[model samples]
Target: MLITDRHGRILIQRVDYRTTCLLPGGAVDADESPAQCAARELQEELGVTTTVDRGLAVDWVSADCLNAPASMRFPGEILHVYDGGTWDDEQIAAIRLPDREITSVEFVEPARLPGLMAPGDARRALSALRARINAAGPALLENGLPIAPTVLDRALRTARARHHLPFHVGPVPEQLSVVQVWGWLLAPDGRVLVLLEPDTGAALLPGGTPEPPDRGDPFITLRREVCEEAAAEFGEPLFLGHLCEPDNPYARLRYAAPLTRLGPPPVDPATGRTHIRILATPEQALELFDWGLPATDQLTAVHQARARLGIPRAARQPLTELPDATDLTTM
Candidate 1:
């Protein structure tokens, strides 16, 4: 099985007998299923009990390719890789290794595994990571790669009608004069950061109409608004799509980013109060946004972002149940 932290760092273990590290897995017992063996091995090796979900990939280690002595090498082996879901820092810290077999456990970046792990093991881990990302959603390439437009991209391009100046959505008649820019800022754990309007008690993404200083770029406007509202910095931004109101000409140019840094929440100049919430799932976002069309579009963008970033989907929750806002002070 392949295990990784929330940020996609592979959890590698150094065996006492082997010079290079490998993933945390072991042979399946005579009567146990692969999943059962994976869970058991994780518990025995790391003293951590976690569910082994869907299989990620499989590796066939040929007898000729074995690095062990001829006597120790078997005819062949088929290894099953499973997805060990993301773990928090505390869970990672609690991992206790069996020193007799495992010398240590460390989280290593995927790119660095090639140098630290056996060639075959490194290939297996990298393959599993790619499979996990592909299964999660559309593959997101590194910056500057030639990426073809995805289905979401095509839809957005076709739906774009007219671009207006940025404006806020409110009860006033003049509020619809321009489009709005909304940012879907996600944390490493896959939770989204949302802003709460103190005056209206509405939960909103950290953005607003572009101010004059924004220089007319939606991305720049969103970056500035996110910093101003949540005291957060945007990572590489991915243009998800446009959320056009059916009844009105107003639309929201939505952008998604894995937040780079988060500081103390500043009072939004527009709202004059500070209260930001982190939603654990898209369903919670929908409920917090009152199940409106904009919320639905935001949910879509969130899904797209998760797929692009290779983040697993958050656990499913009741569609109508609203979770309490996690105040910025607690974040």
Candidate 2:
């Protein structure tokens, strides 16, 4: 079973027998279906009874692929992964592991799985996680490799190389140069705009560096870049925060702006690269962004700005490409 908490951290176990951490599950018993086995294993391992639905992934492990004791006679196994659903703080608090086998349980960030678990296990877990988030039904895998891989799966293949910027929810320091300006361009429904690279599925907020035409003004750069990248217009922007990396004297500023008009999909004039525009809730936006935990604080700042700007919380929905000319004034 693949389980996650509200913050998107996956539940992994430290078993006394294995050096690599494992996702909470055990061998399937006879006369039980995969779903039944998932539920049973979850309850037995974590002492929590939750309904398991939607097989996130199915993997066929070849015989002799696994490292096992010589006497165990390991045969090929068909593995099933099911979504255990997101657990709340109270539910997490209620978890009780047995006295043996599983020595401890941890809710770890998905990015850390590679360092903690076996390589194949890490790949399978990540694929399953992407399946759940993509809402594209189940994924098929062979030895933890996706048969028909997803955009997210492909993007996450180099998880260790992802860049992270330390976010600060305050004014950009006066001594530092404001290097880039990005907008948390929020629709009336409170979903923020995210720009996706058409080919690589890389995500970014719609903004850019200050151009000569921008007169070195961050807001002007924001407006021009938003128009260039997402083909959109917005009302006054409220500065939410900035991000700075170590050994750098520059800051990347972020603002929350109410989107006024959304035009058709845009092909960035500078790069001539067509970008996909999508509106995602702050939580989903955080997932799409590769930044680490500090991204959460940035979103929290965006939420405060949203409340002050009187934007409504968007209802949960699957992420889809932004349609042309969504008039927000009438929404």
Candidate 3:
């Protein structure tokens, strides 16, 4: 129990047979620490406030139950008292006790404390409280231990390492291509194009031929297929190249379009250049059936590219990344 008043006056509660009043305190509970117990009781007893700075006093009372006041030595049980503060008389008078164990109370001034309380272990509490007051500003820790610098480096490092890894989307294996092709992009609006497969017959786009490793040419086969199928003498297929193989389906549908078909001629008569079929408006060409190849996605990709590469259709087998006009290179 602790006793303190607002204006530096000490509270003494009369309990047991002590001639004078003693500071109010109680036994620590079974599972509570001494500091915590002290604070709890101090608040419960004195209606006044209490705070524990380091532990103020520690004493042992043995065979307290003996009536003969036998001089038994203290073995284990220890009592911890705190040098809480003092209050003014008015504040002291306001302090009340839990009626069960306390009989009366009193306020004692430091100069006249000796005569008011029994001169036993209780007197020691007064001396301790005074020493605490003399120490000045900084208060003590609840358990008398000093707080020091602590490092959390390893913990921080562990957290960062675990949290920084990229989220795995899924598995994708790289694929090598074995063919290269080209198509005749027709339509004044660029909405229709042409392709072809050897056995399946003439596709609107003319392209298809097994490619040799690094054949050093994409139009290599485009010329052959165009002449064989359309006999249309193209000056080397201005090389708009390959579609996906339908195998390498891109994660987000590789919509990278390298499509560049010939544009309409200028109205200037002397602007001498051969007429070409780059922009084929839907109104001019018949709506041929969409590419009906086994690779539906690849056909879809080619379809999308013909229609302004609407969305990046995923890479599909039979459809491969196309080569630029300069990339005479083959798969």
Best by TM-score: 2
Model 1: how far residue 149 lies from native, Å: 20
What is candidate 3's CA lDDT for residue 250? 26
TM-score of 3: 0.33
lDDT for each candidate structure: 0.63, 0.82, 0.39
Candidate 1, overall lDDT?
A: 0.63
What's each prediction's TM-score?
0.45, 0.70, 0.33
Model 2 regions more than 4 Å off: 4-27, 42-80, 85-127, 134-164, 323-325, 328-331
Identify the candidate with maximal lDDT. Answer: 2
Poorly placed runs, candidate 3 (over 4 Å)? 1-8, 16-19, 48-53, 60-77, 88-94, 136-331
C-alpha RMSD of each candidate structure in angstroms: 17.5, 5.4, 36.2
TM-score-better candidate, 2 vs 3: 2
lDDT of 2: 0.82
The sequence of per-residue lDDT tens digits that candidate 3 reaches over residues 1-331 is 4454432345677775555666777778889988787778777776555667665555443445222434443343455667665455566566667766677776544334556655444344544443343232222222221122111100111111111112112232345343435454332223333322222221234444534542635445554444443333333222222334344542211111333332232221222322222112221111122222222344444454545533222221111111112111121
